[model samples]
Target: MTTVTEAVPPAPAKHRDQVATSLPPARGQSFLKLVTLELRKSVDTRSGRVLIAAILLLAVAAVGWQLTHLPRGTINFDGFLAAATSGPVMILPVIGVMAMTSEWTQRTALTTFTLSPRRIRVQLAKFVSAIVLGAVVTTGVVVLALAGTALGGATSGRATSYAGMGGEIAAGYLTVALNVVMAAAFGAVIAQTAVAILVFYIAPTAWRLAGPELFKDNANWLDVFGALGRIAERDLHGMLPETLTAIGVWIVLPTLVGLWASSRREVK
Candidate 1:
């Protein structure tokens, strides 16, 4: 009987350790919290702070420009608002550019992506943060305009007309949002502060100057400022398609590229 018996395998263990269990899903940072963090990061650094201050200073400088150039009683808020935003509009997008590029140049992408493994969410948060900064700067421009309006009125002993310009305000915000978003998109694509800034400024200017030669009136399709300027004038009744086309090319296209680039961008 012993010779006939064969060794049998041990029965399968039924230990609880072998049980397949679902883990509570790993928690992630909230999108709004991500946006808030990005927003803070936008202004937390020394250079960022300086750039923001420079934006407001430019607004004040616009006020001075109005005070000196415009005759008394003609110091309308509409004009002040327009003048206040002109220089800042050019400078404001730089904030968006820096907000994105600084993270790369300063070597903080490692920390940023480590905390938020979903790179797209982080990139998007930064994008939204730049738009939010544009809004904040726009509000500052309004406040400076109102103050300048009062000062101009008092100093000139002239009546100030707000013009109750709703269209202009709306157009201003749209223009600003577009510019900042475009700037951020360029930074995302280029991933360098200086190059992004130069390209963002130069490419548009170059295109504006040279495109007319190559494409004629049709060149306006690729003219970012020309399209945006028309929109800013509240002249979208007939040019909406043209404006959208330009935006699609400059903003939507680059944004897609930037998101793709940022998602794959290597972090050191």
Candidate 2:
């Protein structure tokens, strides 16, 4: 029997499924790293670079316009800075909108959300990046304004008056932050680039024109643009509460909505 029977091969060992030994450390990583990534995104793309160039060009044009058109007596540092900043202020918020909406518009949300599952931090990083970029743009415009001021002063024989300029410069930075971040919040809530920009511009402009007619004085509290105007004028002394209220209504509320919208939006 032993000679006739072939020894059966040992039964193959049953395969067992192995469990994952460890999980990845929660969703969080480095926030600074996230901001750095966002800053790269803002400046790295062709469109982004084009927009930056356009902003600088428009700023230079503004300075040049003032140099050519304005009376020499009025071509002081303050007026030049104000003129130079105007074009950028209008354009800067577009960058904010792009910062918040570009991922959605370009269909990169899936990867972004996948890599950084906590979406709020991602939104915040983009917002911070927009602010930083706005600051850089502002600095550039300030330099142009200064150069123009020097030229204007030399040609016109008017001393570069810095009477209240220190205050105005500080106020200008505040206005830029408020507008850019507010636009970013709007973009985050909408998650669409074109529509967000349209609304961000139209809504405030419409209110600025009509709300004063309809709501009388109460529009001050709801008018972010008006508050920003007051801030730009460095005239918030008597109306700090109302100015803050407007900022709260426009900036803080929209920012909260944007964070929530971004976090919960489907990542398809």
Q: Give the per-residue lDDT digits (tens) of candidate 1, residues 1-268.
A: 3577688976556544354344465677999999999999888999889888998999999899888877744667888898899889989999779878987999989988888889999889988999998898899998899899899888888887877668778889989999999999999999999999999999989999999899888988888898889988877657777788999999999999999999998899
- lDDT at 168, model 1: 78
Which pairs clash in the backbone of model 2?
none
Model 1 CA lDDT for position 68: 81
Q: Model 2, 19-121: lDDT tens per residue?
A: 2325444555799999999999999999899999999999899999988876745556788887888778899888899999999999999999889888889
How many Å off is the CA of 95 in candidate 1? Answer: 1.3
For model 1, the superposed segments whose C-alpha errors exceed 4 Å read: 1-26
Q: lDDT for each of the candidates?
A: 0.88, 0.88
TM-score of predicted structure 2: 0.86
Worst lDDT run of 10 residues, candidate 1, spans 14-23
Model 2 residue 71 CA deviation (Å) reads: 2.6
TM-score (all chains, Cα) for each model = 0.88, 0.86
Error of 1 at 140 (Å): 0.6
Model 2 alpha-carbon miss at residue 124, Å = 0.7
